[model samples]
Target: MTVRIVTDSSCDLSADDIERHRITVVPLTIRFGDREFVDGRDLPAERFYEMMANSDRLPSTAAPAPGAFETAFRELAAGGADAIVCVNLSFALSATGESAQAAARSLTGEVDVRVVDSGKVSAGLGLMVKAAATAAEGGHSATEIETQLAELKDRVLIYGVLDTLENLKKGGRIGAAQALLGSALSIKPCLDLTSGTVQEAGKQRTRGKARAWLAKKATEVGELEHLAVAHGAADDIDSFVAGLGDTPARHPTTVTLIGPVVGTHAGPGVIALAMVPAT
Candidate 1:
């Protein structure tokens, strides 16, 4: 069976990875005050960060409409795909998954469509999409790929060190991390997004210590199947990744700019690590 993979822009998969795997990405929309732009289409990550820094208010994100996913699924079916599996960011965080499911239901008889909520964002979602696409290329059925993602999502871990809690607080995604607000000035807040919720992991006295804690957390996870570092306009990303010091990974480390959708809430100077512990 010829299987195809689809995902939202939040995954942060590189252009090469998307093109190589023939994965379809439906874009979400970002609004800055009165203006709005498509995630990956009109808005580049650099430009988005520039706009965010200049604007007085935080940007907002909107999930794609069901018609968008429907259109993507139809195009893939026309391309002779026997089945299409869409992996999306967590339902708890956004309505993107619901939009995809609505689209899948609309295509009930015309083609086979399945959607998987990654329970992750950014690099964590990216890694899962890459794996699914690779499995599809190797002729795995939609059911098989879905099953693999079920196990993989649990092993996926996402840790972040935010430069500020202002973005999260303003965006109303602070959740349990709100406790850091009073002391937000004295420390760099570490975040845990592994459970699809923004929870407080810990805080460090300085940026260097916060990033070091991230690398240490990865090391403590033991063997890893995949590893990636994502940052939001962070200039020190290279040095941060270098500190990993020959960490073992089944795949080469992926360093990507956090896209506007995630960067909107993560704010600037955010550095995140995503990894999957080997079974």
Candidate 2:
């Protein structure tokens, strides 16, 4: 059976991976004040960051309508896919997963569409999508892949150091990380997003210290099954990865730019690490 993968723009997977896996990416809407643009389509990351740098208010994101996901599923079914798995951003964070679920319900028996709540965003979500696409390519049944993902989600760990909490504060996504707001001016906030909601991981006086802390945390986790580095237009990404030392993984580590959906909240100069533990 031919299984294809579908995901939203928030996954932050590389273009090559998408093409290689024949994965379909539905886009989310990003609003810069009154002007709205499709994530990654009309509003590329570079352009979004440029506009954000000049704007006084934080941009907002909207989940794609159910029709958008239905269109993607129908197109894939028409292209001869026996089954499709639609992985999406965390259901706890965005309504993207709900939209995909709605679309899947509309398909009924015409085609099989499994909507998975990745419980992650950015490269954390990207890692799961990549694995799903790989499973599809390997001829794994959609049901099997879905079961694998359910187990994989709990093993995924995502941590990041944000340059500022300004975006999180403005976007109202602070969650349990809100306590960091009190000391935002004095320290860089380290966020743990493994739970699909932002929580405080640590605090650092400097960016370098924060990066080191991230690397140390990864080391303490032992060997990794998959590793990915995601950043929001950060220039120090190379150095940040270098500090992580050797990461033993089944696949080569992926370094992806944080797309508009994630970038909207992470803000600029935000760098994060997402990984799965070796089992």
Candidate 3:
């Protein structure tokens, strides 16, 4: 059966990447006071960050309705796709996974839709989506694609340094990284994706040191099969990516702007690194 790929906006894959891989993306909703904007559709990342920087209120996120996923599945099924593999952000972090599964169940005998919890967020999740898309485009069966995705999820690593803790503080909710508080603004916290939730990786006294440590953390994972440098409108990102040692001979690094979903909590000026271990 012909297979297609689907993912939520939180995966952090750009429009170009999605189109290039023929992947379907479902957007999450972002609420700013009285108004709400669709993650990637209505509010672009640049404008969202700009508003974030100027506003004192912390924006909230809501998972897409199950109907959204069902619509996407129905459309793709109508377009001649025999199956769809949907990879979403971690369930530990958001309800997007639950929404996807509900939609999958609703389409029971009609469309073959499989929802996968990446156990990751941001580009870490993006890597798996890309892997699934690549596998499907190569004629891999649905079963084969699912098996590859399961393996890839465990090998993914994500590291990020938030520019401010206010986003987390203002959001009034943090899973297990509560200890990140009680420190002054002088401390920059480095976080990693662990067991589906954001956790404190370490702390740096300055953005400069945090950047270096983030680069160093990537090397600890050994050679990478895929590596991406992501940021929230940070100008030093190019320079920061350059400091990440040397990319493996044939593997060039990918640079993408982090979208609204992940960018909301990571905040503006956040720089991140996501990679998959070499096979």
lDDT of 2 at 70: 98
Write model 3 residue lDDT over 45-160, tens digit each, in one string. Answer: 88998888788787888889999999999999999999999999998888898999999999999988889888988888888898899899899988899899888888888888
lDDT of each: 0.94, 0.91, 0.86
Using alpha carbons, what is the TM-score of model 2? Answer: 0.97
Clashing pairs in 1: none
Model 3 scores a C-alpha lDDT of: 0.86
**Candidate 2 clashing pairs, residues 3+ apart or interchain:** none
* Candidate 2 lDDT, 1-279, residue by residue in tens: 999999999999888888888889999999988999998789889888899999987999999999999999999999999999999989988999999999999999999999999999999999899889889989999999999999999999999999989988888889998789889999999999999999999999998898888888778888888888999999898888787667677768878889889999889999998999999
For each candidate, C-alpha RMSD in Å?
Answer: 0.9, 1.2, 1.4
TM-score order of candidates, top first: 1, 2, 3
Predicted candidate 1 versus true structure: per-residue lDDT over 1-279, tens digit per residue: 999999999998888989998989999999998999999999999999999999998999999999999999999999998999999998888999999999999999999999999999999999999999999989899999999999999999999999998888888889888889999999999999998889999999999999899999889988888899999999899899889988888778889999998999899999999998877
What's the C-alpha lDDT at position 216 in model 3?
86
| Residue 85 alpha-carbon offset, candidate 3, angstroms | 0.8
| By lDDT: ranked, best first | 1, 2, 3
Question: What residue runs in model 3 are displaced by over 4 Å at the alpha carbon?
Answer: none
